[model samples]
Target: MSADGGGHLKMYILIRESVPTGFAVLAAAHASLAAYLKFRDAPEVAEWLSGPFYKAVCKVTDEEFEKAKAFEDHVVLTESALGGQEVAIAFKPRREWPKAFRFYRLYRS
Candidate 1:
């Protein structure tokens, strides 16, 4: 649920801050689609597809990127153009998230 306990669902895409701006945007898009394919059958994904569908793209430090991997319902995206380096992570849509997620900085140029 949202902070207000609504029925909204959201997916989160976290890109490494070190990635270039253009690559970061592509990474977020790639990660979103990949994560959706991976979790397409999930009830949460279905519910999200039925709703307005919200997403947050955040810039993460290297440490935060590692920490994001601790979540189970996520897809790690490796950029072949970047020598196979991991560039982003996309979490499955959910009604709620860990409190720490609220602190991630939004991706901004």
Candidate 2:
């Protein structure tokens, strides 16, 4: 929150889940800086077969704190380098090939 109590960056993450129970929510935030977090244990086939999924709970409160601090101080999301995600995830845009010639034209005697 700012002097007037307003957040700068808001984020929404998408994960696959389906259960008769209910919705799942999670977050971690700082006093006035930033935050980040994740939600899981949806009880879907994958969740159960994968991790014995069940009812979830809040793992981190005041989440956005870290992200807010990072933006305030201009830090990068390199935690993936540490252990979050495998690096080297590069995207090379597809190249368009040149148009093909309809037919060959030549002079003959």
Candidate 3:
């Protein structure tokens, strides 16, 4: 979308809750950068980059991360230290926010 009719581009970054604060931040960063690079050419992402880029960092359990990977439009971040665990997930920017993500709140730490 072109940020018209109140449809703004937004990316959701979900990180594993059990990870340390530093690791969580790193994972979230990795996810965000990966998503941006992957979708940078899209019109919505380009608009977001040109204007105010919006992102939401949320906490997700390991189970949640696993489930989220099933989504087609997601980028997963893996960490070897965590035993090749999926540390974070970044969903492609969408005009309509997915209802599935309603449970995830903003990252506190």
Candidate 4:
């Protein structure tokens, strides 16, 4: 819960820069769905799912992706097209945005 009584949960999707735009979109989608399903039963996740369910997609370097993979709350997405390389990482809903991930920028057209 937030000060204004709104849910503070938000999902963060990070796509590896090496991946092409099309593949990146697919990878992020897969990671997001997987994370949502994996945590759907939690109270905070349930509240987030029932309403706005905010999500943000950002670009990350290979090194950053590796670092994010070690987080317990994240899901790493890989595919044959990526030659077994991780294409994206999605984080479970968090009350506050992570400071360590501040360097990444939002996905843009």
Candidate 5:
């Protein structure tokens, strides 16, 4: 653990420029180095975040930010109370994500 007792495991909130309605949360566990992310449609991930297993989400890393291109594995159109829009979230396993190098550190969001 770090001096603050903060493990390498962390959470970040992801909002896509394409779908801005909601946020995606990414979670990394301390011991196992297992990363879990939150997605609206992926009930398993949502359920995991709903429990105490989550460390943090929606965090802006201390390092600089790297912009990612907009890519859609799947898209959905929503009809929420506010308006008709599409929103989605993603959880990334460590293996599935690439090293996001910013100012000095690596980030997933």
Candidate 6:
């Protein structure tokens, strides 16, 4: 689903641009699971699971990654391979998000 598209509930996993591709892949997966586990009881998460369950894996700069932390409905993931640096964030599934979320580019090799 498009980030700005309406209807289906969605989640976003934003990985730092500095992380290597392979590690970024792993970070996205870990971040997804972490967010799901951490917010499994939330109404949005439950509704999301019952519906379309959309997700996006986007790339962001380190500055954007830090800024994402200001949003409360997310889980930040740290990679031990990268000396425990915060590498990614997985946001809880919801119907609405901050406008900046729509501009993050989808991660590509």
Q: Count the backbone clashes (under 3 Å) in each candidate.
A: 1, 15, 0, 0, 3, 0
Q: Estimate candidate 4's alpha-carbon lDDT, on a 0 to 1 scale.
A: 0.78
Per-model CA lDDT versus the true structure: 0.90, 0.19, 0.80, 0.78, 0.29, 0.90
What is the per-residue lDDT of model 2 for residues 6-93, given as tens digits with 9 covering 90 to 100?
2222121111121011221211111111111111222222333343222111111223322223322121222232354211111111
Count steric clashes of candidate 5: 3
Q: Model 2, stretches more than 4 Å misplaced?
A: 1-8, 20-23, 26-109
Distance from true location, Cα of 1 in model 4, Å: 14
CA displacement after TM-score superposition, residue 47 of candidate 1 (Å) = 0.7
Could you give candidate 4's per-residue lDDT for residues 14-34 as a string of tens digits?
Answer: 998888999988888898998
Q: Once model 6 is optimally superposed onto the true structure by TM-score, how far is the C-alpha of residue 26 displaced, in angstroms?
A: 0.5
Model 3 ranges with Cα > 4 A deviation: 1-6
In angstroms, the error of model 2 at 77 is 18
TM-score of predicted structure 1: 0.93
Q: List the residue pairs that clash in candidate 3.
A: none
TM-scores for all candidates: the values are 0.93, 0.15, 0.85, 0.85, 0.26, 0.93
Model 5, residue 60: displacement in angstroms?
A: 9.3
Report the poorest 10 consecutive residues by lDDT, candidate 3. 1-10
How well is each residue in 5-109 modelled by candidate 5, as lDDT tens digits? Answer: 333322333333333223322121211122231233454445544554533222222222223223222122232533643332223311123333121222233
Error of 3 at 105 (Å): 1.9
Error of 5 at 93 (Å): 4.2
Top TM-score model: 6
